[model samples]
Target: MKSYSAVVALAGLVSSVAAHGFISSPTPRQPGQGLKAACGDQVYNQQSSDHFGNVQGALQNLQGSQPDCRMWHCKGVPFSDAGEVFDYTPGQVIPMKVEIRAPHDGVANVSIVKVSSDTVIGQPLISWDQYALTSSPLSQHPDWTSFDIKMPDVSSECAKAGDCVIQWYWDAPKISQTYESCIDFKMGGGSGGSAPSPSASAAPASSAAPKPSSAAPATSATPTATVPAATPTPSKVEEVATPTASSGAGEGSTLPKSFTIDSFITWLRANAGSDTATKVSRAVAERAHPRAFRV
Candidate 1:
Protein backbone atom coordinates (compact mmCIF):
# COMPACT_ATOMS: atom_id res chain seq x y z
CA MET A 1 0.00 0.00 0.00
CA LYS A 2 2.91 2.39 0.76
CA SER A 3 4.62 1.61 -2.59
CA TYR A 4 1.36 2.27 -4.53
CA SER A 5 0.93 5.63 -2.78
CA ALA A 6 4.49 6.71 -3.68
CA VAL A 7 3.93 5.81 -7.36
CA VAL A 8 0.68 7.82 -7.41
CA ALA A 9 2.38 10.90 -5.91
CA LEU A 10 5.22 10.75 -8.48
CA ALA A 11 2.78 10.47 -11.36
CA GLY A 12 0.82 13.52 -10.19
CA LEU A 13 3.99 15.63 -10.05
CA VAL A 14 4.92 14.62 -13.61
CA SER A 15 1.49 15.50 -14.92
CA SER A 16 1.52 18.85 -13.27
CA VAL A 17 4.91 19.77 -14.82
CA ALA A 18 3.74 18.58 -18.28
CA ALA A 19 0.64 20.79 -18.23
CA HIS A 20 2.60 24.09 -18.48
CA GLY A 21 4.69 24.61 -21.63
CA PHE A 22 6.62 27.70 -22.76
CA ILE A 23 5.38 30.79 -20.81
CA SER A 24 6.28 34.48 -20.59
CA SER A 25 5.89 36.52 -17.42
CA PRO A 26 4.28 39.94 -16.91
CA THR A 27 6.47 43.06 -16.90
CA PRO A 28 6.78 45.13 -13.74
CA ARG A 29 5.21 48.59 -13.45
CA GLN A 30 8.34 50.08 -11.81
CA PRO A 31 10.67 49.24 -14.76
CA GLY A 32 12.38 46.13 -13.45
CA GLN A 33 12.07 42.52 -14.69
CA GLY A 34 8.38 41.71 -15.24
CA LEU A 35 6.44 38.58 -14.31
CA LYS A 36 6.52 35.88 -16.99
CA ALA A 37 4.16 32.96 -17.57
CA ALA A 38 5.68 29.53 -17.12
CA CYS A 39 6.00 27.26 -20.16
CA GLY A 40 2.98 25.02 -20.51
CA ASP A 41 1.30 22.48 -22.73
CA GLN A 42 0.61 23.71 -26.28
CA VAL A 43 -3.02 22.77 -26.30
CA TYR A 44 -5.56 25.31 -27.65
CA ASN A 45 -8.81 23.84 -26.28
CA GLN A 46 -10.13 23.78 -22.73
CA GLN A 47 -6.83 22.56 -21.36
CA SER A 48 -4.96 25.61 -22.79
CA SER A 49 -7.63 27.89 -21.25
CA ASP A 50 -7.05 26.31 -17.83
CA HIS A 51 -3.29 26.71 -18.19
CA PHE A 52 -3.58 30.41 -19.06
CA GLY A 53 -6.11 30.90 -16.30
CA ASN A 54 -3.62 29.50 -13.80
CA VAL A 55 -0.99 32.02 -14.93
CA GLN A 56 -3.33 35.02 -14.68
CA GLY A 57 -4.68 33.89 -11.33
CA ALA A 58 -1.15 33.56 -9.96
CA LEU A 59 -0.26 37.16 -10.91
CA GLN A 60 -3.45 39.08 -10.16
CA ASN A 61 -4.81 36.52 -7.70
CA LEU A 62 -8.22 37.11 -9.33
CA GLN A 63 -10.89 34.55 -10.37
CA GLY A 64 -12.22 36.66 -13.24
CA SER A 65 -11.95 35.73 -16.96
CA GLN A 66 -8.46 34.68 -18.08
CA PRO A 67 -6.17 37.73 -18.60
CA ASP A 68 -4.99 36.83 -22.09
CA CYS A 69 -8.38 35.50 -23.21
CA ARG A 70 -10.39 38.47 -21.94
CA MET A 71 -8.97 41.18 -24.15
CA TRP A 72 -8.14 38.84 -27.03
CA HIS A 73 -10.45 36.46 -28.87
CA CYS A 74 -8.03 33.55 -28.29
CA LYS A 75 -8.93 30.71 -25.98
CA GLY A 76 -6.06 31.66 -23.58
CA VAL A 77 -4.24 34.93 -23.30
CA PRO A 78 -0.66 34.59 -22.10
CA PHE A 79 -0.37 36.04 -18.59
CA SER A 80 1.44 39.38 -18.32
CA ASP A 81 1.73 39.56 -22.11
CA ALA A 82 1.37 43.16 -23.35
CA GLY A 83 2.49 45.21 -26.35
CA GLU A 84 4.64 48.36 -26.28
CA VAL A 85 4.43 51.80 -27.88
CA PHE A 86 7.19 53.84 -29.59
CA ASP A 87 7.61 57.18 -31.43
CA TYR A 88 9.06 57.67 -34.91
CA THR A 89 10.07 60.69 -36.94
CA PRO A 90 8.90 61.30 -40.48
CA GLY A 91 10.82 59.49 -43.26
CA GLN A 92 12.46 57.21 -40.71
CA VAL A 93 13.00 53.52 -41.40
CA ILE A 94 12.25 51.34 -38.41
CA PRO A 95 12.89 47.63 -37.89
CA MET A 96 10.23 45.92 -35.81
CA LYS A 97 9.59 42.44 -34.37
CA VAL A 98 6.34 40.95 -33.10
CA GLU A 99 5.38 37.62 -31.49
CA ILE A 100 1.77 36.43 -31.65
CA ARG A 101 0.17 33.25 -30.33
CA ALA A 102 -2.74 31.91 -32.32
CA PRO A 103 -5.22 29.40 -31.02
CA HIS A 104 -5.86 27.69 -34.34
CA ASP A 105 -4.75 27.44 -37.95
CA GLY A 106 -5.15 30.78 -39.74
CA VAL A 107 -3.35 33.65 -41.42
CA ALA A 108 -2.10 36.87 -39.79
CA ASN A 109 -2.04 39.87 -42.12
CA VAL A 110 -0.30 43.14 -41.13
CA SER A 111 -0.40 46.37 -43.14
CA ILE A 112 -0.14 50.19 -42.84
CA VAL A 113 -2.20 52.72 -44.76
CA LYS A 114 -3.12 56.40 -44.72
CA VAL A 115 -5.77 56.82 -42.05
CA SER A 116 -8.77 58.68 -43.36
CA SER A 117 -11.00 60.44 -40.85
CA ASP A 118 -13.91 58.26 -41.81
CA THR A 119 -12.08 55.04 -40.96
CA VAL A 120 -9.72 56.25 -38.17
CA ILE A 121 -8.19 59.41 -36.78
CA GLY A 122 -4.45 58.77 -37.30
CA GLN A 123 -2.70 57.10 -40.26
CA PRO A 124 -1.33 53.55 -40.55
CA LEU A 125 2.34 53.30 -39.59
CA ILE A 126 3.31 49.70 -40.48
CA SER A 127 2.04 46.47 -42.03
CA TRP A 128 3.20 42.98 -42.97
CA ASP A 129 2.31 40.22 -45.38
CA GLN A 130 -0.12 37.56 -44.20
CA TYR A 131 1.61 34.90 -42.12
CA ALA A 132 -0.19 31.56 -42.29
CA LEU A 133 0.02 29.00 -39.50
CA THR A 134 -1.15 25.45 -40.22
CA SER A 135 1.19 23.19 -38.23
CA SER A 136 -1.20 23.06 -35.29
CA PRO A 137 -4.81 22.57 -36.54
CA LEU A 138 -7.92 24.15 -34.90
CA SER A 139 -7.43 22.45 -31.54
CA GLN A 140 -7.82 25.76 -29.59
CA HIS A 141 -4.17 25.30 -28.62
CA PRO A 142 -2.05 28.37 -27.98
CA ASP A 143 1.00 28.37 -30.28
CA TRP A 144 3.38 31.35 -30.43
CA THR A 145 4.80 32.61 -33.73
CA SER A 146 7.25 35.48 -34.29
CA PHE A 147 7.60 37.86 -37.25
CA ASP A 148 10.03 40.61 -38.32
CA ILE A 149 8.66 43.66 -40.16
CA LYS A 150 10.44 46.68 -41.68
CA MET A 151 8.44 49.92 -41.74
CA PRO A 152 8.61 52.15 -44.79
CA ASP A 153 9.28 55.90 -44.72
CA VAL A 154 6.35 57.99 -43.53
CA SER A 155 5.30 60.79 -45.88
CA SER A 156 4.60 64.29 -44.56
CA GLU A 157 1.29 64.33 -46.42
CA CYS A 158 0.04 61.17 -44.74
CA ALA A 159 1.46 61.62 -41.22
CA LYS A 160 2.16 64.75 -39.20
CA ALA A 161 3.53 65.62 -35.76
CA GLY A 162 0.81 63.62 -34.08
CA ASP A 163 -0.09 60.18 -32.85
CA CYS A 164 -0.38 57.17 -35.17
CA VAL A 165 -1.87 53.73 -34.55
CA ILE A 166 -0.28 50.36 -35.44
CA GLN A 167 -2.69 47.48 -35.82
CA TRP A 168 -2.06 43.74 -35.53
CA TYR A 169 -4.62 41.29 -36.88
CA TRP A 170 -4.50 37.56 -36.19
CA ASP A 171 -6.60 34.91 -37.97
CA ALA A 172 -8.14 37.51 -40.24
CA PRO A 173 -9.89 35.43 -42.87
CA LYS A 174 -12.83 33.59 -41.37
CA ILE A 175 -15.68 35.54 -39.74
CA SER A 176 -15.25 34.04 -36.27
CA GLN A 177 -11.43 33.75 -36.49
CA THR A 178 -10.53 37.43 -36.33
CA TYR A 179 -8.47 38.97 -33.50
CA GLU A 180 -7.40 42.66 -33.38
CA SER A 181 -4.83 44.58 -31.33
CA CYS A 182 -3.35 48.07 -31.63
CA ILE A 183 -0.51 50.25 -30.26
CA ASP A 184 -0.64 54.04 -30.24
CA PHE A 185 2.71 55.74 -31.05
CA LYS A 186 3.59 59.34 -31.83
CA MET A 187 5.68 60.66 -34.80
CA GLY A 188 7.87 63.73 -34.25
CA GLY A 189 10.81 65.04 -32.15
CA GLY A 190 14.54 64.84 -33.01
CA SER A 191 14.57 61.09 -32.96
CA GLY A 192 15.80 58.88 -35.79
CA GLY A 193 12.90 60.11 -37.92
CA SER A 194 13.25 63.10 -40.26
CA ALA A 195 11.54 66.39 -39.42
CA PRO A 196 9.88 68.96 -41.70
CA SER A 197 12.64 71.13 -43.25
CA PRO A 198 13.64 74.50 -41.78
CA SER A 199 12.48 76.24 -44.97
CA ALA A 200 8.92 76.06 -43.74
CA SER A 201 9.79 78.32 -40.80
CA ALA A 202 10.91 81.19 -43.04
CA ALA A 203 7.57 81.57 -44.84
CA PRO A 204 5.85 83.72 -42.18
CA ALA A 205 8.77 86.14 -41.90
CA SER A 206 8.15 87.51 -45.42
CA SER A 207 4.56 88.53 -44.70
CA ALA A 208 5.25 90.61 -41.56
CA ALA A 209 6.56 93.78 -43.25
CA PRO A 210 4.13 96.60 -44.26
CA LYS A 211 3.71 97.73 -47.87
CA PRO A 212 4.34 101.28 -49.21
CA SER A 213 1.36 103.61 -49.82
CA SER A 214 0.41 104.51 -53.40
CA ALA A 215 -1.42 107.81 -52.69
CA ALA A 216 1.68 109.96 -51.84
CA PRO A 217 2.91 112.61 -54.34
CA ALA A 218 5.79 111.53 -56.61
CA THR A 219 7.78 114.82 -57.02
CA SER A 220 8.46 118.12 -55.13
CA ALA A 221 8.42 121.73 -56.55
CA THR A 222 11.54 123.96 -57.22
CA PRO A 223 11.99 127.45 -58.85
CA THR A 224 13.37 127.78 -62.43
CA ALA A 225 14.70 130.83 -64.41
CA THR A 226 13.30 132.17 -67.73
CA VAL A 227 15.54 133.51 -70.55
CA PRO A 228 15.07 137.10 -71.91
CA ALA A 229 13.94 137.61 -75.54
CA ALA A 230 16.34 139.18 -78.15
CA THR A 231 15.50 142.66 -79.55
CA PRO A 232 15.61 143.42 -83.34
CA THR A 233 17.45 146.50 -84.76
CA PRO A 234 18.17 148.17 -88.18
CA SER A 235 21.65 147.84 -89.78
CA LYS A 236 24.25 150.50 -88.86
CA VAL A 237 24.83 151.40 -92.57
CA GLU A 238 21.19 152.52 -92.85
CA GLU A 239 21.94 155.75 -90.92
CA VAL A 240 24.81 156.65 -93.29
CA ALA A 241 22.82 155.86 -96.44
CA THR A 242 21.55 158.51 -98.98
CA PRO A 243 18.27 160.30 -98.14
CA THR A 244 16.49 158.62 -101.09
CA ALA A 245 17.53 155.14 -99.90
CA SER A 246 16.57 156.02 -96.29
CA SER A 247 13.10 157.17 -97.40
CA GLY A 248 12.55 153.84 -99.20
CA ALA A 249 13.76 151.87 -96.02
CA GLY A 250 11.28 150.52 -93.54
CA GLU A 251 10.20 152.40 -90.37
CA GLY A 252 12.68 150.32 -88.26
CA SER A 253 15.55 152.14 -90.03
CA THR A 254 14.87 155.19 -87.81
CA LEU A 255 16.06 153.14 -84.70
CA PRO A 256 19.74 153.27 -83.70
CA LYS A 257 21.37 149.83 -84.52
CA SER A 258 24.63 150.74 -82.57
CA PHE A 259 22.61 151.30 -79.37
CA THR A 260 21.01 147.79 -79.68
CA ILE A 261 24.45 146.22 -80.22
CA ASP A 262 25.85 148.05 -77.17
CA SER A 263 22.94 146.80 -74.97
CA PHE A 264 23.55 143.17 -76.09
CA ILE A 265 27.34 143.48 -75.24
CA THR A 266 26.52 144.88 -71.78
CA TRP A 267 24.04 142.01 -71.00
CA LEU A 268 26.53 139.38 -72.20
CA ARG A 269 29.34 140.86 -69.94
CA ALA A 270 26.99 140.90 -66.92
CA ASN A 271 25.97 137.24 -67.33
CA ALA A 272 29.39 135.86 -68.42
CA GLY A 273 31.47 136.36 -65.22
CA SER A 274 33.69 133.30 -65.95
CA ASP A 275 36.37 133.60 -68.63
CA THR A 276 35.16 130.43 -70.33
CA ALA A 277 31.63 131.82 -70.90
CA THR A 278 33.10 135.18 -72.09
CA LYS A 279 35.30 133.32 -74.62
CA VAL A 280 32.27 131.40 -75.90
CA SER A 281 30.24 134.64 -76.30
CA ARG A 282 33.17 136.35 -78.11
CA ALA A 283 33.49 133.40 -80.47
CA VAL A 284 29.75 133.61 -81.25
CA ALA A 285 29.92 137.39 -81.81
CA GLU A 286 32.92 137.03 -84.16
CA ARG A 287 30.92 134.63 -86.32
CA ALA A 288 28.44 137.47 -87.12
CA HIS A 289 31.36 139.88 -88.07
CA PRO A 290 33.80 137.43 -89.63
CA ARG A 291 35.63 139.95 -91.89
CA ALA A 292 35.99 142.66 -89.16
CA PHE A 293 37.29 140.27 -86.43
CA ARG A 294 39.75 138.36 -88.69
CA VAL A 295 42.87 139.83 -86.92
Candidate 2:
Protein backbone atom coordinates (compact mmCIF):
# COMPACT_ATOMS: atom_id res chain seq x y z
CA MET A 1 0.00 0.00 0.00
CA LYS A 2 2.89 2.40 0.72
CA SER A 3 4.54 1.62 -2.63
CA TYR A 4 1.26 2.28 -4.46
CA SER A 5 0.83 5.56 -2.63
CA ALA A 6 4.36 6.64 -3.60
CA VAL A 7 3.69 5.74 -7.25
CA VAL A 8 0.49 7.86 -7.28
CA ALA A 9 2.32 10.85 -5.80
CA LEU A 10 5.13 10.54 -8.38
CA ALA A 11 2.66 10.34 -11.26
CA GLY A 12 0.83 13.48 -10.05
CA LEU A 13 4.11 15.37 -9.68
CA VAL A 14 5.25 14.42 -13.20
CA SER A 15 1.88 15.43 -14.65
CA SER A 16 1.96 18.82 -12.93
CA VAL A 17 5.57 19.46 -14.03
CA ALA A 18 5.04 18.53 -17.67
CA ALA A 19 1.62 20.05 -18.37
CA HIS A 20 1.27 23.85 -18.52
CA GLY A 21 -0.44 25.92 -21.21
CA PHE A 22 -1.03 25.90 -24.97
CA ILE A 23 -3.14 27.64 -27.58
CA SER A 24 -6.41 25.73 -27.90
CA SER A 25 -8.29 27.66 -30.58
CA PRO A 26 -7.13 28.09 -34.19
CA THR A 27 -5.41 24.73 -33.78
CA PRO A 28 -1.73 25.34 -33.05
CA ARG A 29 1.19 23.17 -34.27
CA GLN A 30 1.27 19.70 -32.63
CA PRO A 31 3.86 16.99 -32.39
CA GLY A 32 4.29 15.07 -35.64
CA GLN A 33 6.85 13.20 -37.76
CA GLY A 34 8.55 16.52 -38.59
CA LEU A 35 8.92 17.35 -34.89
CA LYS A 36 10.44 13.92 -34.28
CA ALA A 37 13.00 14.51 -37.05
CA ALA A 38 13.92 18.00 -35.90
CA CYS A 39 13.75 17.47 -32.11
CA GLY A 40 14.88 13.79 -32.18
CA ASP A 41 13.08 10.73 -30.79
CA GLN A 42 13.68 11.40 -27.09
CA VAL A 43 12.69 15.07 -26.94
CA TYR A 44 9.99 14.59 -29.57
CA ASN A 45 8.42 11.69 -27.71
CA GLN A 46 8.48 13.67 -24.49
CA GLN A 47 6.62 16.55 -26.07
CA SER A 48 4.38 14.16 -27.95
CA SER A 49 3.25 12.68 -24.66
CA ASP A 50 2.52 16.08 -23.18
CA HIS A 51 1.87 18.87 -25.70
CA PHE A 52 1.84 21.54 -22.95
CA GLY A 53 5.48 20.81 -21.91
CA ASN A 54 7.72 23.89 -21.44
CA VAL A 55 10.65 24.89 -23.68
CA GLN A 56 13.30 24.52 -20.94
CA GLY A 57 12.33 20.90 -20.40
CA ALA A 58 12.60 20.21 -24.14
CA LEU A 59 16.01 21.95 -24.26
CA GLN A 60 17.32 19.72 -21.44
CA ASN A 61 16.48 16.58 -23.42
CA LEU A 62 18.07 18.18 -26.56
CA GLN A 63 21.55 18.47 -24.96
CA GLY A 64 23.45 15.72 -26.83
CA SER A 65 21.49 15.64 -30.07
CA GLN A 66 22.19 18.39 -32.66
CA PRO A 67 18.82 17.60 -34.28
CA ASP A 68 17.43 20.64 -36.10
CA CYS A 69 15.93 21.67 -32.76
CA ARG A 70 15.28 25.29 -32.00
CA MET A 71 13.67 24.66 -28.60
CA TRP A 72 13.46 28.35 -27.91
CA HIS A 73 11.46 28.97 -31.11
CA CYS A 74 7.97 27.47 -31.38
CA LYS A 75 9.07 24.64 -29.06
CA GLY A 76 11.30 23.22 -31.82
CA VAL A 77 8.35 22.54 -34.12
CA PRO A 78 8.78 23.01 -37.89
CA PHE A 79 6.48 24.25 -40.65
CA SER A 80 6.29 20.85 -42.32
CA ASP A 81 3.77 19.76 -39.67
CA ALA A 82 2.10 23.13 -39.13
CA GLY A 83 -1.15 21.77 -40.66
CA GLU A 84 -3.74 24.25 -42.05
CA VAL A 85 -3.00 27.96 -42.32
CA PHE A 86 -5.62 30.39 -41.05
CA ASP A 87 -6.52 33.08 -43.56
CA TYR A 88 -6.68 36.65 -42.21
CA THR A 89 -6.70 40.26 -43.40
CA PRO A 90 -5.64 43.62 -42.03
CA GLY A 91 -7.76 44.94 -39.14
CA GLN A 92 -9.43 41.58 -38.73
CA VAL A 93 -10.45 40.60 -35.22
CA ILE A 94 -9.43 37.00 -34.54
CA PRO A 95 -10.81 35.11 -31.56
CA MET A 96 -8.20 33.04 -29.69
CA LYS A 97 -8.56 30.46 -26.91
CA VAL A 98 -5.86 28.99 -24.71
CA GLU A 99 -5.82 25.97 -22.37
CA ILE A 100 -3.94 26.38 -19.07
CA ARG A 101 -3.48 22.96 -17.51
CA ALA A 102 -1.23 24.39 -14.77
CA PRO A 103 -0.70 27.96 -13.61
CA HIS A 104 2.74 29.57 -13.18
CA ASP A 105 2.61 33.32 -12.79
CA GLY A 106 4.47 34.96 -15.68
CA VAL A 107 4.32 37.36 -18.60
CA ALA A 108 2.69 36.40 -21.87
CA ASN A 109 2.27 37.98 -25.34
CA VAL A 110 0.93 37.12 -28.73
CA SER A 111 2.88 38.34 -31.77
CA ILE A 112 3.27 37.69 -35.45
CA VAL A 113 6.63 36.06 -36.08
CA LYS A 114 8.51 35.26 -39.26
CA VAL A 115 8.99 31.49 -39.22
CA SER A 116 12.41 31.32 -40.91
CA SER A 117 14.22 34.01 -38.90
CA ASP A 118 12.06 33.79 -35.77
CA THR A 119 11.77 37.60 -35.84
CA VAL A 120 8.66 39.37 -34.59
CA ILE A 121 6.98 41.24 -37.44
CA GLY A 122 5.37 43.92 -35.30
CA GLN A 123 4.25 44.83 -31.80
CA PRO A 124 2.41 42.12 -29.91
CA LEU A 125 -1.28 41.76 -30.74
CA ILE A 126 -2.01 41.29 -27.06
CA SER A 127 0.06 41.05 -23.87
CA TRP A 128 -0.16 40.67 -20.16
CA ASP A 129 2.68 41.75 -17.91
CA GLN A 130 1.37 39.35 -15.27
CA TYR A 131 -0.43 36.28 -16.58
CA ALA A 132 -1.49 32.90 -15.21
CA LEU A 133 -0.72 34.03 -11.66
CA THR A 134 -1.39 31.62 -8.83
CA SER A 135 -2.09 34.47 -6.39
CA SER A 136 -5.05 35.78 -8.42
CA PRO A 137 -8.23 33.77 -8.85
CA LEU A 138 -8.65 32.40 -12.37
CA SER A 139 -12.16 33.90 -12.44
CA GLN A 140 -10.77 37.44 -11.88
CA HIS A 141 -8.85 37.53 -15.21
CA PRO A 142 -10.89 35.79 -17.88
CA ASP A 143 -8.77 37.28 -20.69
CA TRP A 144 -5.92 35.02 -19.67
CA THR A 145 -7.59 32.06 -21.32
CA SER A 146 -9.65 33.66 -24.12
CA PHE A 147 -9.12 36.91 -26.01
CA ASP A 148 -9.15 38.59 -29.42
CA ILE A 149 -6.20 39.70 -31.55
CA LYS A 150 -6.60 42.28 -34.30
CA MET A 151 -4.66 41.61 -37.46
CA PRO A 152 -2.12 44.14 -38.71
CA ASP A 153 -1.24 45.35 -42.20
CA VAL A 154 1.71 43.09 -42.75
CA SER A 155 1.45 43.61 -46.54
CA SER A 156 3.30 40.97 -48.53
CA GLU A 157 5.49 39.54 -45.79
CA CYS A 158 2.88 37.06 -44.53
CA ALA A 159 1.11 36.51 -47.84
CA LYS A 160 2.07 32.84 -48.08
CA ALA A 161 1.34 29.88 -45.88
CA GLY A 162 4.04 28.51 -43.54
CA ASP A 163 5.88 31.84 -43.69
CA CYS A 164 4.47 33.30 -40.50
CA VAL A 165 2.69 32.38 -37.26
CA ILE A 166 0.68 34.00 -34.51
CA GLN A 167 2.90 32.87 -31.67
CA TRP A 168 1.88 32.90 -28.00
CA TYR A 169 4.90 33.18 -25.69
CA TRP A 170 4.78 32.84 -21.94
CA ASP A 171 7.87 33.22 -19.76
CA ALA A 172 8.12 32.58 -16.01
CA PRO A 173 11.36 34.31 -15.01
CA LYS A 174 11.24 32.99 -11.44
CA ILE A 175 11.07 29.36 -12.54
CA SER A 176 13.18 29.81 -15.70
CA GLN A 177 10.45 28.18 -17.76
CA THR A 178 9.17 29.30 -21.15
CA TYR A 179 6.25 28.01 -23.21
CA GLU A 180 5.29 28.70 -26.86
CA SER A 181 2.31 27.96 -29.03
CA CYS A 182 2.31 28.83 -32.75
CA ILE A 183 -0.78 29.11 -34.94
CA ASP A 184 0.22 29.07 -38.60
CA PHE A 185 -1.42 31.79 -40.66
CA LYS A 186 -1.29 33.66 -43.98
CA MET A 187 -2.34 37.31 -44.39
CA GLY A 188 -2.33 40.12 -47.02
CA GLY A 189 -2.91 38.53 -50.39
CA GLY A 190 -5.40 38.57 -53.30
CA SER A 191 -7.84 41.52 -53.56
CA GLY A 192 -8.62 41.40 -49.86
CA GLY A 193 -5.09 42.33 -48.83
CA SER A 194 -3.89 45.77 -47.76
CA ALA A 195 -4.27 48.44 -50.44
CA PRO A 196 -1.21 49.15 -52.58
CA SER A 197 0.88 52.19 -51.53
CA PRO A 198 0.04 55.56 -53.13
CA SER A 199 3.24 55.58 -55.19
CA ALA A 200 2.71 52.05 -56.43
CA SER A 201 -0.94 52.65 -57.42
CA ALA A 202 0.01 55.81 -59.35
CA ALA A 203 2.80 54.14 -61.31
CA PRO A 204 0.71 52.94 -64.29
CA ALA A 205 -1.06 56.27 -64.61
CA SER A 206 2.25 58.15 -64.64
CA SER A 207 3.68 55.86 -67.33
CA ALA A 208 0.68 56.38 -69.66
CA ALA A 209 0.61 60.21 -69.54
CA PRO A 210 3.07 62.39 -71.51
CA LYS A 211 5.69 64.03 -69.33
CA PRO A 212 6.64 67.68 -70.00
CA SER A 213 10.11 68.18 -71.49
CA SER A 214 12.43 70.44 -69.46
CA ALA A 215 14.14 72.05 -72.54
CA ALA A 216 11.04 72.46 -74.74
CA PRO A 217 9.99 75.88 -73.27
CA ALA A 218 13.44 77.54 -73.48
CA THR A 219 14.99 75.91 -76.60
CA SER A 220 12.12 75.96 -79.13
CA ALA A 221 12.41 79.30 -81.00
CA THR A 222 9.50 78.90 -83.49
CA PRO A 223 7.62 82.07 -84.49
CA THR A 224 4.38 80.07 -84.28
CA ALA A 225 4.98 79.72 -80.53
CA THR A 226 4.53 83.51 -79.99
CA VAL A 227 1.13 84.73 -78.60
CA PRO A 228 -1.99 83.48 -80.43
CA ALA A 229 0.07 81.97 -83.27
CA ALA A 230 0.40 78.67 -81.37
CA THR A 231 -3.22 78.84 -80.15
CA PRO A 232 -5.38 76.48 -82.21
CA THR A 233 -8.48 78.73 -81.95
CA PRO A 234 -8.69 80.67 -85.26
CA SER A 235 -12.38 81.58 -84.89
CA LYS A 236 -11.51 84.15 -82.13
CA VAL A 237 -9.09 85.99 -84.43
CA GLU A 238 -11.59 85.85 -87.36
CA GLU A 239 -14.45 87.12 -85.17
CA VAL A 240 -13.09 90.70 -85.37
CA ALA A 241 -14.51 92.22 -88.61
CA THR A 242 -11.75 94.42 -90.14
CA PRO A 243 -10.94 96.01 -93.50
CA THR A 244 -8.23 93.69 -94.84
CA ALA A 245 -7.24 91.82 -98.05
CA SER A 246 -10.04 89.27 -97.56
CA SER A 247 -12.90 91.87 -97.40
CA GLY A 248 -11.32 94.88 -99.13
CA ALA A 249 -12.06 96.13 -102.69
CA GLY A 250 -9.42 94.10 -104.61
CA GLU A 251 -9.90 90.26 -104.52
CA GLY A 252 -6.23 89.57 -105.45
CA SER A 253 -4.80 92.31 -103.23
CA THR A 254 -1.50 91.45 -101.49
CA LEU A 255 -1.80 92.91 -97.96
CA PRO A 256 -1.67 91.56 -94.37
CA LYS A 257 -4.63 89.29 -93.49
CA SER A 258 -5.09 91.06 -90.11
CA PHE A 259 -3.72 94.49 -89.33
CA THR A 260 -2.91 96.15 -85.98
CA ILE A 261 -2.95 100.01 -85.48
CA ASP A 262 0.71 100.34 -86.56
CA SER A 263 0.20 98.06 -89.60
CA PHE A 264 -2.87 100.17 -90.67
CA ILE A 265 -0.75 103.31 -90.50
CA THR A 266 1.92 101.71 -92.67
CA TRP A 267 -0.71 100.58 -95.20
CA LEU A 268 -2.27 104.10 -95.26
CA ARG A 269 1.17 105.68 -96.00
CA ALA A 270 1.64 103.32 -98.95
CA ASN A 271 -1.91 103.86 -100.23
CA ALA A 272 -2.21 107.63 -99.65
CA GLY A 273 -4.15 108.05 -102.90
CA SER A 274 -7.13 105.92 -101.75
CA ASP A 275 -9.82 108.17 -100.25
CA THR A 276 -11.68 105.19 -98.61
CA ALA A 277 -8.49 104.00 -96.91
CA THR A 278 -7.75 107.52 -95.70
CA LYS A 279 -11.23 107.82 -94.18
CA VAL A 280 -10.90 104.49 -92.29
CA SER A 281 -7.40 105.41 -91.05
CA ARG A 282 -8.67 108.75 -89.62
CA ALA A 283 -11.53 106.94 -87.79
CA VAL A 284 -9.08 104.43 -86.20
CA ALA A 285 -6.72 107.24 -85.18
CA GLU A 286 -9.63 109.18 -83.56
CA ARG A 287 -10.69 106.10 -81.54
CA ALA A 288 -7.10 105.31 -80.42
CA HIS A 289 -6.22 108.88 -79.32
CA PRO A 290 -9.44 110.83 -78.64
CA ARG A 291 -7.69 113.91 -77.09
CA ALA A 292 -4.95 114.07 -79.78
CA PHE A 293 -7.45 113.79 -82.70
CA ARG A 294 -10.17 116.04 -81.07
CA VAL A 295 -10.50 118.33 -84.12
The TM-score leader among the candidates is 2
Error of 1 at 180 (Å): 1.7
Error at 282, model 1, angstroms: 99
Instruction: Give the least accurate 10-residue stretch of model 1, judged by summed lDDT.
Output: 286-295
lDDT of 2 at 18: 31
Against the true structure, candidate 1 reaches a TM-score of 0.29
Any residue pairs clashing in model 2, and if so which? none
Off by over 4 Å in 2: 1-19, 191-295
**Total clashes in model 2, counting residue pairs 3 or more apart in sequence or in different chains:** 0
Residue 178 alpha-carbon offset, candidate 2, angstroms: 0.5
TM-score against truth, every candidate: 0.29, 0.59
Each prediction's Cα lDDT score?
0.29, 0.60
